[model samples]
Target: MEPRPPSEWEDRVRELARQFSYPPAPDLRSRIPRPGVRRPRGRRWAWAAGAFGAFMLALGILLASPARAGLLEFLQIGAVRIRLQPPPTPSKPAATPSPASGAIPETRMLGILDLAGETTLEAAQAQVPFPIRLPTYPPDLGRPDHVYLQGMGGPAVILVWRDPMRPDRIRLALFEIGPGALIEKITPQVLTATTVHGRPALWVEGPYLLQTRSGRWELRRLVEGHVLLWTEGEVTFRLETDLGMEEAVRIAESLSAP
Candidate 1:
């Protein structure tokens, strides 16, 4: 291979380079002292950066998901939306109970609907879709004497059975749950699961605490005995009576469409 001749600007370029010598790079490594002294700070900064990156990644994942937005946890069913977590601690004290009614005053967050009325069985059945079941064990008991509708969470059928021996005595409050309703099982109530009519059922005995517009009402009016809860198809049934567990089970098993 033959050596090529230099260009016309080669000498000029070399002269210019020599006139203005390239400056040496500053020793950044020397400026940064021994690694031992700064090791803790570097580690802390590294950890902070890593944590920030992880948080950003997690936030991105949460935002990407359309199902869960923001921090509030919830269970959505049809038109109803229930919080999976208890509400945030209230900043203000709860409203005072009323004097005349002796019930918790109704508020935006709290509500109540007393459906106990002197209505006929046929009239109540005409309103809902599900077949209302009446206990067949005590045939003489026949149809419910008083019917009530729990019109709050969902359309639920409340059947009252007056004492056979004493017609004035209200003995039972049975209810049938409507479709897509959310049943919130709160504290202070003994919740047990048993089978009735070969179907899984939840039995609640003793007093249970609940929040209502009537303030906080401990539901123990006539439910001193126990409650038998069972679901048939999309509908859920609950029999609130002062009867024993065995009797409740027997009654639940004998539930037949009227």
Candidate 2:
């Protein structure tokens, strides 16, 4: 039998198929899992955790060492670093004559004349590169009784004031250490953090061993009074006095170049 003529519905379906467009089929061979191959998941997270653990282990080992622990327990301000130390041992008393037996007790005082590089204030100012400053808080405070200059890589100027009543005793001393000079203080007492003229400072009480080092010179002094340490510009100021913290800070804030 002869094929029947195409119907209208058949013609319409053919026309619709011709007008439609389709995308090419994607290749699935590469994406399919192989029999013996395993993919690594979360590998980045595992690496991160291992690295963190190693850092923590190294830090713990460093903190456990006794000799190394002292390296971290210091406070540095300007050119000075203060370290905590154990209290010094007390010495046994020696036999001596009584005060009522016409014997005078020896008094130890800071000897300004014994310091190196003793010179006039004008001479010190001429030798140093930085300006010399003096405090004006105590209106009656006059000029320094003595001035000393130390060559510690750079110039270190010291100004000393003597008590009028007790000429043998020192009333105040101001140390101006320039760059390259280093000071190390060892104290058994705790140090208090303070501020002078809004700048950071350190207040140390009681007696301490003060050591200063330069190129080839090193000096050690036993400081009996309190100390105020701070930095202004490139110079570090150390004020040694018997005054309280509030008064010391006030004096520090009143410093002016003269």
Candidate 3:
């Protein structure tokens, strides 16, 4: 019969037999030395030791030099000098004021009326003269025809009007209404009516007042004369001339109301 299938043990035996053949040993021909071979005497370590000693000696010499110590000290001194310097200073500015409060002052009364009336009249009379010369009236008459005295004194022009029933009325009219013309520029103030000599009379503001038993005299200035007139109701009496306002007031205070 054909070769039967080999048993497992037989196959393993065959494989082992195949592997048992010895392989040829590697050739150990010539024993040659590698190029640049060195002996292990630790020469590299010795050279390293010598170089380290030389570096240490150089470092020690450099440290011992005065210049090196001086250079280090100079660096330290420069650092201290930089630290010691002061910083820059700043400038100051001017002050200003606020804008809330206003300006200007205040006042009271302004006109002449606010002053005392009698006092002002006295002041006015002191400055001027009265009972001045009357220029010839009715300027049409020829020279020296006839001289008739209309007014009481030299300069006062007393007017006489014909009224049979009121013959004495013309004399009474003088104090009530002055002459036809205002001779002096009289700045009139307040006027009040008073009873003098037991009759109605007017108290007009002027130089000042002299109310006496004789009559009421007022300081007045005509064109050329400064005179005092005693006015009692409708009657006017011419008194002393050339009197001042202050003097008139003084003279007035001395008299009694009549």
lDDT of each: 0.53, 0.63, 0.27
- In candidate 1, stretches whose alpha carbon ends up further than 4 angstroms from where it belongs are 1-89, 93-118, 206-221
Q: What is the C-alpha lDDT profile of model 1 across 96-161, one tens digit per residue?
A: 422111222222211114333335678767877777778887667787777765443556666777
Position 87, candidate 2: lDDT: 24
Ranking by TM-score: 2, 1, 3
Comparing 1 and 3 on TM-score, the stronger one: 1
- Model 2: number of clashes? 0
Candidate 2 Cα misplacement greater than 4 A, ranges: 1-71, 85-109, 206-223
Spell out the clash pairs found in candidate 3: 126-245, 129-221, 130-221, 130-222, 130-225, 130-226, 131-222, 132-222, 151-158, 197-258
| Model 2 steric clash pairs | none
Q: Which window of 10 residues has the lowest lDDT sum in candidate 1?
A: 103-112
Q: Please provide TM-scores, in order, for all candidate models, with all chains considered together.
A: 0.52, 0.59, 0.16
TM-score of 1: 0.52
Of candidates 2 and 1, the better by TM-score: 2
- Say which candidate scores most in TM-score: 2
Query: 181-219 in candidate 2: lDDT tens per residue?
Result: 766665425466566765567787543222222221222
Clashes of each: 2, 0, 10
